[model samples]
Target chain A: MDKNYNIDEIENFLNQEMSAEDLSSFKERLAQEDGLQEEVDFHATIVEGIKQSAELDFRALVQDTRKAMLQEENTAAKVVDLNQNSKSRVRSLGSSRIVAIAASLALLLVAAWWVFLSPMSPERAFASNFTTPKDVLSAEVASRLEETGFANNQAALQQLQEAMLTYQNDNFEQAQQQLDAFQAQYPNNEFAAQAAYYEALSAINTSDYETAQVKLLDLVDTPNFALQSDAKWYLALNSLHIGNIELAKTLLDSLQSDSKHGTAAQGLLRRLR
Target chain B: METSTIVEQLRTGNQQAIRSLYQISFPECASFIKKNNGTNNDAEDCFQEALVVLYRKVSDSNFQLTSNIKTFLYGITRNLWLNELRKRSKSGLKLVMDEQSDREYILTADDQVEQKQEEEVKHKLIAQAIQRMQGNCKDVLINFYFKKMSLREIAAKMGFTEQYAKKRRYKCMESLKQKVRTEYATLGL
Candidate 1:
């Protein structure tokens, strides 16, 4: 083995860029060389390792996406609980009042066909279903630190925690600023997706639908974003909020089979119809 | 989406396709794993591994799907969990597979032994080495090799001359090779 063998020559050979004569000579050398073949194999393994690293990154994305979906499902479950409580409250009403109320409800049902049964306006549907997603960032970060015993990016996590606190406090404007700063400072951090997600939510809460749409669209297009499906669902609502009914329909149609949002999407579709 | 479309989209690294798969397939997979002795975390791990296997297989131009994507993924996940159980010396426990016909899609040569144990070890070492590398070096090497970016494009993207980019890539590769060698020696490989 030549100690002075050029790495470029090896790269060219591996990449199949070598001329036939050079290739033949290189092949013959490769056949006879002791350490050269091992070096080539090592380089090849490094390339494979790099590719595997990218795949692992994608796997992380998939894991985060799953976690986000689970969080959304929990939020939906809370909404369902609220509905159940309302139903139970109705059940607890006195019998005499219930009977009187039932008589009025029967009369109201006839009027409801003429009033509520008409196709709901897109803005109304958006308002009805678009609750702000519950703030789970703090819990998630705490659990992650507990599990790992060390935060890989402690400073970023701290900043995100502060921003999430602002979000939780209903200070949408400041939270959006802090999240934007977090994103700017740590564009490739693991929690950047979460930051982006919260920023979009803030925009929605502030009635900045255009900004919300832009941010949510970026999330929708981002291949590894954890809140991608949530972004899609919210983007649909944002579209409806802005009276882009067709876009809302299209987005909702895509999410019509999403486990967390599917039932809501179907109900909205019915109203839109 | 159709199974074929999912396969194609996965090959392209489309997240929508991945989301679709999770939406349509993962609940059943999770239930099956939990029905057995596995936890939800175990099910997630097996499902991710199965998706990786599927991605690798479909990347090969000669590969063909003989079953639906869901069934194929279920088969792979079941096999993975079974192997894991065997590793834990719990193979005596029977896995509650919902469908017997799913056995037809069990991964054979491709999944069980995708790489020799030695090769897998080497790859892991290399991955560790890459992770420990400096940001610029790692980026240059990955962009050139894994990303298939031309030197000119990389140079433009990184704000350097093409010649410098090529030299930087070579230096990065050398650095990575040295790191891998050190790690390999540390492992007493």
Candidate 2:
């Protein structure tokens, strides 16, 4: 076995960037190099996580785009297109934009604009797409993201994005480590809330509902949060997932009566029933 | 319902045909902007660009399809939509909060030079495998498949008797078949 089967080599293999000759050689060496394959699988998980996230992101983007096109036409015809956008049963705003909206919303709550959006704005209708497009989460990551200010810091943001891909690929330990690192590095950074939120989501994806709930519960009141509403939404959804109808109803109640979420939330609420 | 057919109908001011084509391909092509990591609004904007591509392709006689009409339209749409997505992803990420998923599909076959490059990759892969043969075997195969040369003419050109040419031709075809199978298998096709 070629003992030189290093981390870089394994990462390259995971990426499918290896030359054909290198692939042939790597295959030849695989029979006896047990550790190498293990390392390769670890990296592969991270790579696949990124891809899965990308796919969800793309699908979400497409759904939102379809709605957006329709909305654009509506925007051309109507004074308050929000009402019409609310009518959409499915749609998603881009993640960063959603986070900004959430943050701005928090800012508005404390400061000047309490409600920047028109009740009829299509944004309300499309909000469900954001969570659907988001990866399954552990409550820990979910709650971490609930702290609105977490999504703003660049370092925290990079670590969280990297962790998201890692978690999706089932590199739980690495993901946890990354999350821990992110929390340690920028606990109050803008991306921190989202990062923490995803940390919880990563746990949820693994079916650790109790842990996920704990993580979410931890972040429920964390101030300066970007995804508090989303965390609440996920908590409510998680209750349904765990077969706790009463708890689910309670969590759902905490969210603005779907009408506040606009038509999309109302539609999702209808579906939940 | 196709841009090509619609273009034909459009030339005669057939409003229904034009609308049918636009209605079918426009939103899909437009929506791809989001599917490949763009905002919903960006996808809407992508429709006009996709229409422009259809307009150009429909006018070009060489743009005949060997595939389904929608697939062709989608191919073009996916290409054009992705191009805009890339441009926006780089510049608009700041204003945009969360990035959309699926960024690995940079440029697909519908995008101008990228389309040509993909075809060239296909040609090169198959052609290189064919190059594995030598001398008469290679020459006979190329003459038959690539040049579309007649057996009698090839025999004369290669200074071979017709009988000898025929025998060589039989062997050459077997070799070609094997090569094609290996090449295609490598591609998992």
Candidate 3:
């Protein structure tokens, strides 16, 4: 701002390029001299001008990259599409661990999500195709069912209890119709919840263990409705039976923590050990 | 990492390298692009071209280091932006400036020569001011002002009362101002 002021020194001082003593001396000089003020204002203006010129245009980059990727994909399509036929004949299965288990089980390779993966509902799976672990009931409970002869309504509940009993006897497919009727009638009940497990076992028998495992988890962990501890063990056992070592180990470990299931599950874990 | 690493990786067509370089450059570039009446689109093109130029120059290996990476990037970006302005003008896409709105821009060589010194000083002052803040004050200010976090998000994430966060931010800003004024009094507006 001062025509006669040395712009360089004031620029250095104001921008703090000046050393401490020099900055102090410059500040003293500024307090006494109006020339330094003008020079600093001028220098700051120059810095602002240069700073204002700096910018980047990334949208243009993305547009260019997209064009390049599209071209690359076009070239790649000819090569990649040729191999599509072979994939149908033999699932590439990729590098995931789930594929390792599925391959051992000869699971249905189609992309249709016949298997649910969420851990929340494991029972609807079991009652659909497999045996419910009647072994989980205490002796008194088992005797009570035998005495009652499972003859409540003799309709949905009776059929469900019968199917559950037959499943306990390992008559998995024989229990299917009864379980289905029971599931439909008492959808919210524990018996209906266990229907999914039988469905799962049926799928597994057909080598569709992927779908079965999902249902097994629900049946195994029914909370205090009389099946939680049993469900976890069964889920773990099936996970192992199907060669899902990781899941099997996790469930088995959890079962080991519950004193009731711990004795039996620990035995299984020891065998695994 | 060094900007040259970005230059090298970009030359090899690494998309992540391209991403990182652009992300790091975004704040500085945004302010500059906004000032020039250029949309974010223009800034991106200029940035890519700057990256391309740097990538091309990186093979020399003997390129003298004259300035901090940000300053070097700023310089290159400045050059490319000026070129973009010229090209856009020729195509008549540029707006003609009104005499009153066209603020006089003056450049002095003195600042350019001493930019590194200025940066070192400013950076230290900023660090000092940031350090002067309390944990909660710093957290609010850094998240809201520097990191551009939303107020609602900051409150939820930090589990702070929203009113308390607001108070902290104001007090923090005032503290920063006081600190900057105390330590570097001659930072003329």
Candidate 4:
């Protein structure tokens, strides 16, 4: 068995590029040789693996495209809903006079905005950009429980689920407490990073900027944290909430290249500048 | 788009074609799934799996579409959701079967679905191995293999000579094989 066998030979055999005589000879050698079959199988696996990788990438593209289409449909539906609500309200009013008054009020509000609004402040920026992170952990935990039949980490997953449910229900302070307890009890759990992340988000939602900032900093520094980019973005927003404009700017600069947060960060940076 | 054109575009991984497929097929598929006690997420998953199955089928040079693309997709999604429902609850399967009996087409077999799942697991292992490779090696192999780039194109893209690109691809492939070997060994496969 040659250590440096040409990979192309295996590829040619697998692809049926060899002549009939050459393939016959190769098959005979494969039968006679001890390791040649293994080598060929290994090469075939690599080839198939590469093709599968490409197919997986294509599947991802399809999924992403579907998501984008669904998002567009949702946005369009929202616009239609708003239009219908406005139309019903207008019909209920049933008065051209009220409509005129509303139009005048809108112009007056615009004039007031032009006359009295100051430059964007850090607090205003934070308020404009910050949204409470959605409770993703609940669904993840539920799916894991379903897959594993609640056999492993049942207690931990249930606790995480309870905390996520609290967060989802807008019980931020209680969620934070529950998350802290989960972290303390299961510091080395596979989902500990996720718990830490939601804990920080809970603090931020409750206007406890200092606590949130500390937790976000820890998350940003944690290796292999799946939500590191998200932590960085929220940490930047936390800095803005605390009037740490310089820190916010620095963090936002770092996030300027992040795919999910880059455009938002760039927009926020421009406003800050 | 025509059915044949859509299939061709999907075979080539066209995003617009995928979006069109979603717009054309998803609403009816979602309605069917929802009627059968499946959520929007389940509908999405089944639909995506159907698309993958369609892509795989059409990738074969001998594949011929016996039905319209939408019909084909709906059949696959229906079968996939039924398979999922059966897994989730056998009691629900009777009700689903009652509803599904009216459908004229069921494109995929249970064994084929299982095969796809098995292939998915294998592909994921390979993808993980590729991810674990060193950066340059990973990039070269991904470019040459997944991206379907020729050695000359990869060389120009990576700003290396063609000869270097060829050698680099071979070495990276060997590295990937070693990584996959370790993965198989770890799983005792």
Computed on alpha carbons, the lDDT of every model, listed in order, comes to 0.75, 0.53, 0.53, 0.76
Summing lDDT over every window of 10 consecutive residues in candidate 1 chain B, give the lowest-scoring window.
Answer: B105-114
Model 2 docking tier (incorrect/acceptable/medium/high): incorrect
- Model 3, span B1-189: residue lDDT tens: 576666565534454455455557756975797799788777766766666555434423444444555665666777667556755665423222222322222332232435756755655555545655667765665555433456776788789778877677666655554565566656762
lDDT of 3: 0.53
Instruction: Note the residue pairs that clash in candidate 1.
Output: none
Q: Is candidate 1 or candidate 3 better by DockQ?
A: 1
- Which is the better candidate, 2 or 4, if ranked by lDDT? 4
Give me candidate 2's TM-score against the actual structure: 0.25
DockQ of candidate 1 compared with the true complex: 0.28
Taking the tens digit of each residue's C-alpha lDDT, what string does model 3 give over A76-117?
343244345645545654556787788756545422222433
| Candidate 4 residue-wise lDDT, A1-273, digit = tens | 347667888878987999999899999989997888989977776766776665676777775555434433443354356556866997887768878899899878856654554557888999999998787778888898788565768898889899989999999999999999999998988889899899989988886665676677777767888898898899888877755566677678767778999999977876776
**What tens-digit string does per-residue lDDT give for candidate 4 at B81-125?**
877787686443322222333345333334455665866676778
**Would you estimate the TM-scores of all the predictions?**
0.53, 0.25, 0.26, 0.49
The alpha-carbon deviation from the true structure for residue B141 of candidate 3, after best TM-score superposition, in angstroms, is 69
**Error at B60, model 3, angstroms:** 54
Q: Write candidate 1's Cα lDDT for B1-189 as tens digits.
A: 799998888766665567678878888888888998999899888888877766666654456777889988878787777767765774334343334454543322223343567788787677667778886887787666655778997899899999999889878877787777778778797
Better of 1 and 4 by TM-score: 1
Residues B40-72, candidate 2: write the lDDT tens digits. Answer: 666655654444444434433434445555666
Error of 4 at B115 (Å): 9.5
* CAPRI-style docking class of model 4 based on DockQ: incorrect
Kindly indicate the candidate among 2 and 4 with the higher TM-score. Answer: 4
